[model samples]
Target: MDGQVNRVPDGGFGWVIVAAVAIINMTNQSILSVFGQLFGGELRRMNEDTFTAALITNLNSLALNFSGLFIGPAIKSFKPRNVAICGCLFVSLGLLICSMATESWHFIVGYSFFVGFGLGLISPSTFMAINSYFSSKRGRAVGVSLAGAGVGQVFMPHVVRYFLDNYDFQIAVLAMAMVSLTGIFGAMFLKPLNPPLQHNNRKHIRLLSEKDVEKCQVTPQAETVHQPSEESFSKKMLSRLVQALDLELLKDFVFWSIIVGMALVYTATINFTMIFPSFLRHSVDLNSQLVATCMSVVAFADIICRLLLPCLTDYLRIPYRVVFLLGTLGLFVARMFLAETKDLRVIIAMSVLTGMMKSATVINNNLTISSHCRSEKLAGGLGLSMMSKGLIVITVGQLLGWIRDYFDSYVICLYAQSVILFLVVIVWSPEIYYRYRRQKRTTTKSIETTIEAGVEEVAKLNA
Candidate 1:
């Protein structure tokens, strides 16, 4: 929303963007979350040990992450939608292969590596590509895009559950394969805001030579057509990455505060989203379908927040920092209350509040990050922020799971998470006032410069 426009706004078939991203996000995320359910079942059927099963899942997570470093470049090089379509193809193929897998290594190599690799390529590309269409309303745009993940979370388990119940595990994998392949068709429709920068160095050289021959001599016009040198290309890449990330933001205090706060928020957020279904089922005797539906309700609530909050933000002129604080606080209270009660209603209530709170934090953080970014650096900065959060999520999610196992209950873990959020707020409180002071100083300098310019103009007139 901060930079460019996608043809046809949200009212038209732009809604397709939401559907496409939702399918992609859902399939990408289910690689870990929904697959966690299949781990034990497949291991048992194959008579393999738990370690081998765990290895498969771990490999998937690792592949999903490290592959991003390269795949992100591919998206920029070609186009996001094309890359996403290819990624979906791989995901679909990998899933189909996984369905026929007969050994532990089959999944370790097939499902974990290949499928995960495809997702790492597709997921972030779609998110970054979609942003070109909604600069001023990027929060809502990102929300719509990210809501796909929520929708995936909502349905994947139930889809898995249906297969596990009605069919066998293999059929379920086939269904996922079909779903991911459908994602390929959806990705085909994505129109990137920026034209892919062509790098046809050899082609450029040939054109220069042809131009020279046509003129019967070397000419300055032909020289202009010569391919840029390799060194120049490398420099261009470095510059592009830097511009994409908006490295100028490192000079601003608020940016650092946001990075730290967002990381803390990620710690709490990933654990809850991943753990909630299992926690509820264990305590409340709900079916996976019910859990999926309940989570969908949360996703819908979150969608509302994503849509409404930005409109409210612009109208109220409220600082996004305050919005961040409020969202974090809501999450803290939800977690604390959740820990205190076993009543199903209470848990459901916590889920609703948690959804809105998480939504708020995301919407505000995105807006702030965009504010810090220069136009050129938008994609790179967003990727950097996401990379940071992704790393933190992997680390903290594992730690929380360990802590929960140690305590035999999730309550203490939630309490510790609440305390962490509280500390994050306290430490970062100065960021708000920092922005306030910078704005005042800028305004004062502009006023003084204007007055001086007016006096000089009058002196010239009098002379």
Candidate 2:
């Protein structure tokens, strides 16, 4: 397996993996994007407060992301394909369980724990599979895969609404469960990369030279020297676990900053998506069909941006952090504007802008980490990022709900989301400027040193 780690096919079958991941993402994201539309109204109808609805909604997010702590190790210990398949089964079962729910706790257990954890498992495995397959065009590959979610967003709401309009709520959820089952077939296509990628100190995947390969080769005699006592075995297991989790990444300032910024941004944006439908229904007084249309408009806009923006950024050679900051800032402005407006046309325009900004941030979410971490540690970095986001969402997400209930307005929630996004911009903008200045200084110093060396070489030759 060590022999093949360096030779990424870069394309070819990698596109196949990309398509499979898109399918999985489409399935996962469609359900999440409309979770509130599906259950929030019903919960409200049952006299459950906004806080209870938010609790149930965020619980799924919490479980989905929190499980990343275990997901990293699980992917390392098992095949990505197998892990994904298991995740699909869990998601399907969870949806089925949701279909039979008679109480709020049932939704919490079924959707929050089971579906969330299942998605947690599927997400990193698919991400790792895509990363393992592509190196040079990773931006485009990730964009294409994420575009699947946009496609889902475009259609799933209407589909869900159709079932709700024609059939019962339980039937709609059951249909969703059957739809989730299709992800298993996609998971099956995630054939393990031969000589699977390994972690190293380098941030990028590079081909190992023959000399490096020789150095990596282990001698039988060296292996025999390590006799495993019970204590030694336990230590070895602990070390392996730690290695798999990539706990060392916590020490990186840039990584931690990215994690925090992305977490806050994600919490704000995702909560908005989950809550927006409810806001439209209760506050804006939009009908179900109109709300579905608005969601589809957002999805349509999202799909256009997801398909175009990443590739454009890659072509322009834009720094991922810069793009992320711009996107977050745009989201903040859009949310603020959205908060002040009740006009449907203005709201639709803001939705379009929000979707575009969302695409930018979502594309860069993992790309930022990938730029900072070693290729092998990508899974761990992503897992830890998800875990951080999960923690923040559960805490802050509930707070948003409380703000809505206390103030008796979803507009307050929108303003609160804008504030959180503003914080992300504040945190990242200065850091980006600092990095730019530092890199410029280093370039200037290197050029001056080169000029001095050239001058001395010419003087010596003339003499």
Best by lDDT: 2
* Number of colliding residue pairs in each model: 7, 1
Predicted candidate 2 versus true structure: per-residue lDDT over 1-463, tens digit per residue: 1123458887789899989989988887678877876887667667788667667767888888988897766776676888899899899999999899888888889998999899888877887788777665667888899998878877788889999999988999999998899998898899876654544322221222333344446586754454345565457556655776888889888888899899999888877877788888888899999997887777788888988987888888788778888999999988888788789998899889888999999888877877777766777888999999998887887687679779998888999998898988888888899989999999999999999999999999999
* Tens digits of lDDT, candidate 1, 46-152: 78885676567656766765564555346555667877888888788888888888887888777788887787777667765665555545555666666667667
Which lDDT values do the candidates have, in the order given? Answer: 0.69, 0.82
Quote the lDDT for 285 in model 2: 90
TM-score of 2: 0.82
Cα deviation of 422 in candidate 2 (Å)? 1.4
Name the candidate that leads on TM-score: 2
TM-score (C-alpha, index-matched) for candidate 1: 0.74
